[model samples]
Target: MTQVHLLDSIFTRLVAWSIAVCTAVVLILGTLVGAKFEQLSVDMQEAAVNADMATLLDAYRDGGQASLASRIDERLNFRTPSGNAPHYLLVAADGRRVAGDLTDWPGIDTGEMTAIPLPDGSYVHARAVDLPAGQRLLVARESAMDEMVLNEIGIAFVIGGLFVVLAVGVAGRITAGRLSKRVGRINAAFKNPDERRLERLDRDRNAQDEIGELTRHSSEALQRLNRLVDAHRDTLDQIAHEMRTPLMHLDARLLRAIRTAPDDAAAQGLVDARGDIRTVIATLESLLDISHSEANRGDPRGLEPVDLSAMIENIADLYAGSAEETGHRFEVDIAPGVTVRGEEMQLTRLVTNLLDNAFKYTQSGGTVCVELVAEGPVLTVADTGPGVPVEDRDRIFERFIRAKGNHGASGGSGLGLALARAIARRHGLVLRLKPTLRGACFEVRPESTVDAG
Candidate 1:
């Protein structure tokens, strides 16, 4: 059960107010009651001092308890005292007691009129009188002490408690609402890469507050990331451009050796050299693509619906025969009209990489399959091969990482999966390997990151 803590910061303030209000009400009521009780007691004492004892005795004997009770009632009513009740008693000489309904004196005597104790532990007025018959008379009034004061105090406490609870609840709700709104704004701004104001705000948090410090640190980290990305892009471009010169020269030398080879072995060596050069060129081109994708990540190009199933089928068909020649069967299971939001060229590259991986890893006579399943706006690509090991599954998507003991010597630069992930991210899509048995399943999550629905 959830408990309300009245001593906490905001609740404490409300509780204090409630206590003050209740105490003030109780104190005021107690003062008025005590003062009135004092005045009534003094009047009763004076009446006892000036009583005609013989007359009181005669009235008590003739009129009985009712007459005595009536006389005290009259005295109190005429006095209009605040603390005295309408019922009282009068004791006569010879130990005879006369009261409205009281059978005995209700309190201890202090030799003077103090408070008349009632059976219920409250007090009123009690006074002793000396009669002319040498008998004594005690006049006492019945009244309730704390019950009336407590009744008033209880009402005040209830009202104060309600106000306190309401105030605390409203304060907490307002606080939570403000915090949620701030969090929502931050999320919306971060999602919009085009919003410079959000970027600036992220850079400006330098105060002592935790959120401010965190924002400042994040801004600094983002700046460093951008710098690293720029440097990486420049390096890739430079390396690719520089390697082209040496690759072209190597191609020229191989061509001359092919044209004037002294023997069949020499000509074959040159052909082998040419193949190696082609592989290097392909690797460099892949690196350049990775760099370009990273550099252009922030570009907000409009998205269009493209048939992903058709693209998957095209790539699978292109490599179907090649896989067959390697003693592996290649097939495609693509649903028709499964449209997605992205560039056609990037999606093609993504599909091709997956198929290539499937063909490269599976043993001879093993089956390689490419599939596209669309559910609503999501696109999935599944392949059956020697699936990636659990520990290296996520690592394979990083740049230049290849799973150990799997497809390491399979003539790839290990950038295929990385490039695919990059392209998917640029289009605001999440690409992750879905868990599966006997195969690798990669999911292209719902394209909700774009401006479109």
Candidate 2:
């Protein structure tokens, strides 16, 4: 069974998408908030600079140029709440050196707040106004505190966003893992419908969730399918039983007619008819055997440790003489101590069917080999003949399906491989046709170590 991992399930993907969407929203909102904070900082600085400019203008109006220059000097040395002094520049009518720190007035419109680069390589927000007698009053303030505040807000957004991503991502992964485990439990319950163990499954079908609904619907469908399969198998068994009686009676009558025939030609005709009837009976018997094997696949009573190496050797010995008489080469490579748990009769038939198929299809003077390896309880039967065609390889194990151009001298009913596969499955084994360079190779082996001794 293929495992359903958390990362491979739909729940995990949905969680990831949700996290991505949330992260994007957080980033967008954080950016907007940060922008608003920066804007507020700029507004407060601009208002402070405009108020200082208004104070200098009032001083100039009351105390003339000299008094305004003196007021500028006083304010320049005064510290604000943030411990940064303001800057001032007073330029004369001829744009000469004024009575403040700046050498010349800035070329800015009256009352326009803009960044002014100072001689110390630092910038300040300033507002300029025309004074009496072509003098210019430029009042400015340092903006370092505003930059620091904006930087702090940006840092906080980054830290908060990262924390949210980590917390939500971990939570989502944990939730998805839990969901995957519940889904796996449902899958385990559905693996074997014949067991009818869905009702015994440990699931919360009453909870209002997608998983609960899925579990309920799956259980219902499996129950219905199982009921239909049981009914169909019962119908087939009844029909086969009903036909077996008539077939036996018909065979007895045919034998009596052959014995009482008046002429050799009439007797031969009766014999042929009996052969045809026997073929039909054989087909029906095979069908019943296949059905029985499938129905009893899970039955523990049919399982026993059988020496597969010994069984293959016995079959090879039985067919060796027939192969040599037909001018064919027969070989066996059986390894001792190769044992597997299965029905002895069915395992023997499985090996015999493979050998029969190999010997039937291979031409005279061809080679047939049967091999058993201790490892994996693996058995291989290979024949040097026309290999199965690529198109027919998939269907060759199906009942009544024969490979194209393979109707050899010994006629076949085409149930040999099908029965072999059925017996293999009933024994928890895998039987497959392997590709070969010159001919065909069929392999049979236990699917797991539990099936092998």
Candidate lDDT scores, in order, read: 0.65, 0.82
Q: lDDT at 417 for candidate 1? A: 91
RMSD of each: 8.9, 5.3
- How much lDDT does candidate 1 score? 0.65
State the lDDT of candidate 1 residue by residue for 1-453, as single tens digits.
123344544434555565566556656655676577656646654464335333455676887656655665565456534543444445555556644446675545534756655666765556655544544456555443334554565566566656665675566556545444444434444444334735654543644665566666655655566567668878877887899878988899889889999999989988998989988888888877877776666544445678887877777777877876888776667788888767788778877776667667777878766666565445555556667888898698998888776557665778899998888777767777878888777766645532332
Candidate 2 residue lDDT tens string, 78-154: 66756245888888888886777787666788768898888888888888888778888888888787777778877
TM-score of each: 0.59, 0.77
TM-score of 1: 0.59
User: Judged by lDDT, which candidate is best?
Assistant: 2
Alpha-carbon shift of residue 431 in model 2 (angstroms):
6.3
